[model samples]
Target chain A: MPGINTSSLPDIIFMLLFFFMVSTTMREVTVRVKQRMPEATEVQKLEKKSLVSFIYIGEPKNTKLFGTKSRIQLNDVFASVDDIPEFIAKEREARDEADRKFITTSLKVDGNTKMGIVTDVKQELRKSGAFKINYSTRKKVERRSR
Target chain B: MARRAAPEINAGSTADIAFLLLIFFLVTTTMDVDTGITRKLPPPVENPDEDVDVKERNVLKILVNSHDMLMVDGKRSDVRLLKDKTKDFMALHPDNPDYPEITTKFIEELGKEFPASKGVISLKNDRGTSYEMYIKVQNELARAFNEMKDERSVELFGVKYSQLVDENKIKAINKLVPVRISEAEPEDIGGK
Candidate 1:
């Protein structure tokens, strides 16, 4: 009796592996800040990944780098509110000319972070003309029906 | 004969290699993209007037104290009940003469005063207030306007407001009850 052909199985599996590898965008920046994202209802997905830039705000995971205070992260480097405009301009230039108009700023702030930093970031964003912003949140069923 | 045994490669391990990679991906693959509450930051004003005193009844006050306690118009309130309360105030307050019905219809058809637009949602949070509570309050206000618009859209066009693609219909739908949450300057941490 002939055994089932196993030669093609590897090819199929490899395709799946490559599919995930290509589609999955691993978290580019390791979140140094401890995050407990606030939950909400009106959540909308980012339309295009290419046009979006993320800003991370929270207390540092390693106290040596950020101490106990909330720190902002732009890309891989820890940033400050003053650095936001420069970072946004740099982020805008890195995108395609056609897509530049749609660039969005994503604020991934920690729950424990004070609103002071957040408001400052918003001011910086408004000043920089990076008008579109997303307050990153999670979704869960609401407590009441009404 | 030597020809009886053809030169052949061992293919049995191919499945193992593939399985190993497949499992690797299965374990490592994460849904990394996150969805959130998207909003537009108003362009910075050239010279903003801080002294403009908005009418008390026209402004719906929402404050998050330093202790993370939520207060709607000085009454201790839960975040869960915030949306309903906001809809009542913003969409149409029963007491507001301009909004005889909790309907934006007058604003849309008659071009008359809109209670929603007149009724500003003033949000002031303490510097010591946790970002979590602040975001929760914002979320509730956002939900209020979205739900109100959707309800009006259903009433007018028989479709969800957000689902409408026609520019005219959208303008007509949200003309009055636009999502307007004014972030007042943060209260100093010293004030508590």
Candidate 2:
């Protein structure tokens, strides 16, 4: 009889809802680069555990450029074109030896960086003797107004 | 027909469930962030057209290990020598129709070397390389190439800088130079 009592049902329902709501948390995906990226309407989902290489260019800590601390992010530097293939081979070997069946290598470039750097990264990755390479991207999630 | 007036069930309970589901998705899903460098890839084909002839011998291959070390044609060199040595190589391959930028005679001449010698740069960036350094390299190459294109337009075609790049032409310019990057598999490369 006590269990079946219906008078306090509304309070029980409210308490259950509150408990469920407080218990849930959001998940986060951490990418390598720390910068504001340019967004694309179309995004490609990359393979999991694949190879993704990041380049950063900025002033070394405590260095002054033009009398002011010249802060250049990693995206500003250039990778020698000649070194690309060997780099790819090394990457391939490392991935294969680790027992990974499939690998996708990607580059996370800077927005302020010039187009040449992006091109060099791509050129090197392709010629690295690896057959397939993936460029990393993020999907545009619709923002909900608070 | 004695009667059956079925009681009307409340619809409000269903609304409560829907509200809970909406809130759950709102809290659990990740927020999207902005990214740079939109790379439009070649169509995925069941079998791609095999890359023919075009001697791979002259192609200078640079390898970046996961440690970010620079390796050129299997030989190690200081980073400072990269641009100068690339320029020298371009000079050797004169009149190679594939890479027009090679004739520029400047550090920018390296971009021509990439495409002309059927140049293939193989980046073997390690998994641990920071994203910041990766992009910095990419941007530097882009700037170098753009300078080459600008110089070539002025030297070879006598086109003014204004004609080369304009507000209306900027979008098209982005398509002119295609950066070729390939990621090699760990297994095929011997897993070093």
Candidate 3:
């Protein structure tokens, strides 16, 4: 018996692999801040990927490099509150006019973080009219029944 | 047709090219999934000094200090009991002749005050308060509204709040007990 030709094996695997790549979103940034999200029972899954921008707040992941300070991360850059409006404006411009109204700012903050920076971030977002804010959290784990 | 056999095309190189591209994308693809709790921030007021006065009776004040302790309506409260207390405060059918959800019999049973239409939840926290505690309180308040909406949904439409697809039905449920959370500016307890 002759051996079967398997020349198209890689092609078959690539097609499936490509589908997975295209179907899922790529991680856009490396988080330099350490974040442990809080848990909430009323969590909602954000439906649209396009209309959301992320803001990460926590202590520096490399505590030695940034001195264990809580920092604000917008995209790949560490930013101050002054940069928030410009960031949101840029984000808004990337969206279609019709979809702009639905744009959301997702806040991923460490549970142990103080509210000082979070409050400032919220104020800046409000000034930018990025009123749709999502607090990233985990679903409440059921520990007991009534 | 034996003399016209189709020319054999090579597919060997195509596999290598695909393999390279596949590896690139496979490594770049992110498996991290993100989900969250969404809140709409009220548009900022022009003047911080200009404010409307709310009756003390119609407001439930929740203060989270630096210690992550909860003060609900001036009383110290456990994080766990926040939900039930919020639910009790949000109870609509506690015997109001006007709302009818608060039937006299219902009020007689539960012994709750007549639910107020103009009730507001004022959430204030010290800057030193942990985000964890803040989020938990928010979750409880949101759950209070959600549970009411869900209960009303079941009574009216025999479905869960999320399953009520009609916009009008949703509006009606919301009108029953409008979500009126007022988050106050945090006090600078972090000393920043």
Q: What TM-score does chain B get in every candidate?
A: 0.70, 0.47, 0.78
Flag the better candidate by TM-score, 2 or 3: 3
| Candidate rank order under DockQ | 3, 1, 2
Model 3 gets an lDDT of 0.81
Task: List the global CA lDDT of all models.
Answer: 0.81, 0.44, 0.81
Q: What is the alpha-carbon interface RMSD for each candidate?
A: 1.8, 9.7, 1.9
* Per-prediction DockQ: 0.66, 0.06, 0.68
Cα lDDT for residue B137, model 1? 85
Stronger candidate by TM-score (1 vs 2): 1
lDDT per residue as tens, model 3, A1-146: 98888876977978877797786677878998988999887888887888889999999888888887789998998999899999999999999999999998999999989887899899889888999999999776767677
lDDT of 2 by residue, B81-147 (tens): 5555444443336665443233222124223322233344344554344343444344334334445
Over B1-192, each residue of candidate 1 has an lDDT whose tens digit, in order, gives 456777698887887888888787777778766888988877887767656666676777888888898888889999889999888776555765643234333654535554434677888888788888888888888888889888978877899987999887788776755677787754485453
Cα displacement (angstroms), candidate 2, residue A30, comes to 12
Q: Which residue runs does candidate 1 get wrong by more than 4 Å?
A: A143-146, B1-28, B49-55, B93-117, B162-172, B187-192
Provide fnat values for all models in the order shown. 0.78, 0.07, 0.77
Evaluation by lDDT, superior candidate among 1 and 2: 1
lDDT of 3 at B13: 80
Give the TM-score comparing model 1 with the true structure, all chains together: 0.82
